[model samples]
Target: MARPTMEDVAARAGVSRALVSLVMRGSPKVSAARRAAVLTAAAELGYSPHAMARSLASRTSHVLGVMVSDLHNPFWAEVVDGLDGHARAAGFELVINTGGRSPARERRALRSLTSFRPAGIALLGPVVPSPAITAAADIPLVLISRSSRLSTVDTVNDDGRAGSALAVDHLVALGHRHIVHIDGGTGSQAAPRRTGYRLAMARYGLAPRVVHGEYTEAAGAAAIRALRRPFTAVIAANDLNAVGVLSALAEAGLRVPADVSVVGYDNTWLAALRHIGLTTIDQPRAEMGRLAASALISRVRGERTKPVRHLLRPTLVTRATTGPPPAPDPMP
Candidate 1:
């Protein structure tokens, strides 16, 4: 069957095409009664306005492009929820794509979003190079879980360094001295988190052991397999990596919190599962999304010029994963 159009809605509502057009555009000139009639008629016919056509007509886009770094991670989903809610409330829609954590794919995803001529774009945990991001400056841009010095772009991020420090301090207070860190290699904000762990370890006069890892369960598992030194606790780059570490430790016949304790970053829903109960850092994923949307929309509306850098605080949520280090092994 042919798709319903504005003319069909106008005819069904017993109104002129121009009136239907006015109603569709949300023109204040239309009476409430006529608006109701048009809406009802359009609903009956399953008629909806073409957003692209409307955008072209007004030379203004009501769509916001969002590039997600990883689709498998639940963290990004929470952020998108916050972003979508705020964008919808502000009369805009979201077009989301993922780069699968690949920098090359991210560059392609960025280009795809730009082709739509959206009002603005939001990049969540993008790994794309600086130049690629800067090239997109023609459109209002917001970065989440990433940083930018461009005076034209905005950023929303949790204090990664502080988050890592919190985890380290919590474990140290529990009498854990030989704690190892599985760092998020090349991931957004990974540097600060790694630095924080090193700095905190130095502050406590303890040696810091870092294992190179990506923000993945596999990476966490691999890091554990690669460990050569004795340690009582581990700080993973993120919750996903922590879970992997848990699995690997179990396979190695080690009981969590009994033989070794673990901590993770990004307290995503996965971390809160009853079976998981990860001790992790809370990054306020939803709030980050909302702030990113607000920043981009504000820029789209020409409300601000100076870059808005939203650096939110992170907190530690203790769960089942962490405990005092096991008593020193009896001398052989």
Candidate 2:
């Protein structure tokens, strides 16, 4: 069957082509009853306006492009949910894609999003190079869980350093002197968290042992298996990594909180499970998402020129994971 067009919609709604066009463009000039008639007719015919063509005609778009670092991580999903809610409320829709945590793939994803000529773009925990990000300055850009020095870009990030310090402080308060931090290798915002951990350890006058790892369960498990020093507690890069540490410790016949306490960042739903209760830092994922969308929309509307950096505070959610260090054996 031939695809329906504005002419067909106009004929079905008993209105002129111009009226149908106005309704499709969301012009307020059209009467409420007439707009309803045209929309109903279009829906009946399963016809919708081509977004790109409409954008080209008006030089504006109702779409906002979003690039996420990893789809497998649930942390991004909460952020996207917040973004989608705010964007939809502002008469905008989101086009989301992921890079799977690969820089090359992220570059390709960025290019694909830019091809749509969206009104604005939001990058969530992106690992793409700074130059690649700067190249997209032609469009309004907001970043979540990433930082930028360019005045054209706006950033929304939780205080990773403060979050890490909170974790270290919690462990220290529980009498854990020997602590290990499994760092997120090359991950966005990793450096701040690592620095926070080191600084906190120094403040406590305790030696900090950092194990290089990626933001993954596999990396967490590997780091634990390769440990050469003794420690009473482990701080994972994120919730996923913390779960991996749990698994590795279980496999090695070590009980949590009894043998070695564990701490994690990013209080995702996975960390709240009854069976796998995890102590972690809360990043306000959804709030960050809303802020990112709001920032991008503000720029798209030409409401602001100065760049904004929103660094939200993080809090600790103590669950069943952390406890005081185990008592030493008294041998004869």
Candidate 3:
């Protein structure tokens, strides 16, 4: 069957193609009754607008493009929900792509989004270089869960340093001293959190042990297994990684809190799951997303040329995973 077009919708509604175009563009000039009739006709014929082609012809776009670093992480998914809601409410649509945490792939994804000439673009935890991001400033750009020194682009991020400190403080309050951190090397927001963990440990007069790892479940499990000495607690890179740590601990016959307490960053849906119930730091994912969208839209509308940097504070949520340190002697 041939695909339906604007002509088909206009014919079905007994209107001109120009009237159908006006209704599709959401122009206020169209009468309410005619708009309803045209929409009903389009729906009945399954005729939807081609956003990219429309953008090219009109030199105006109602679409926003989004690029995510990793699709497997649930945190990004939740953030996207908030972004999509706000975008739709503002009479815009969204299309998404992921780079799977690869810098080269992320660069390519950025190019692909810009090719559409969207009203704006949002990058979530991108691993690409600053220059690549700066170049994309030809259109409005906003970053979530990442930072940039560029004045043209905006950024929305949780204070990773403070978030890490909260985790350390909570663990110390629970009587843990010998704690190890699973570091996310080169991942977005990794350096600050690593530095924060080190500083907090020194402030508490304890040695900080950092195991290099990536932002993935497998890396977390591998890093935990590589630890030679018995540590009182493990602070993971994120909730997904913490879940992996739990699996590795279970396999090693070490009971959580009784043997070692675990703390995770990014209080995502997985962290709140009844089965997982992980203790983690909350980054206000939804609000961050909304801020990113609003900032990008503001830039698109020429409301502001100066960058908007939105730094949010993170809070700690204590759950079943973290508790007091185990006694010196192992129970038989």
lDDT of 1 by residue, 1-332 (tens): 89998889999999998999899888999999999999999999999988777787778899999999999888999999999999999999999999999999999999999988899999999999999999999899999999999999999999998999999999999999999999989999999999999999999999999999999999999999888658999999999999999999999999998998999899999999999999999999989999999999999999989999999999999999999988887999
Clashing pairs in model 3, backbone N/Cα/C closer than 3 A: none
By TM-score rank, best first, the candidates go 1, 2, 3
Writing each residue's lDDT as its tens digit, candidate 2 over 107-188 gives: 9999999999999999999999999999999889999989999999999999999999999999999999999999999999
Give candidate 3 regions above 4 Å deviation.
31-37, 330-332
The estimated TM-scores of all candidates read 0.96, 0.96, 0.95
Total clashing pairs for each candidate: 0, 0, 0
lDDT of 3 at 44: 97
Look at candidate 3 and tell me the lDDT of residue 179. Answer: 94
Return the clash pairs for model 1, or none. Answer: none
Cα lDDT over the full model 3: 0.91
The lDDT for every candidate, in the order shown, is 0.94, 0.93, 0.91
Name the 10 consecutive residues with the lowest summed lDDT in model 1.
Answer: 50-59
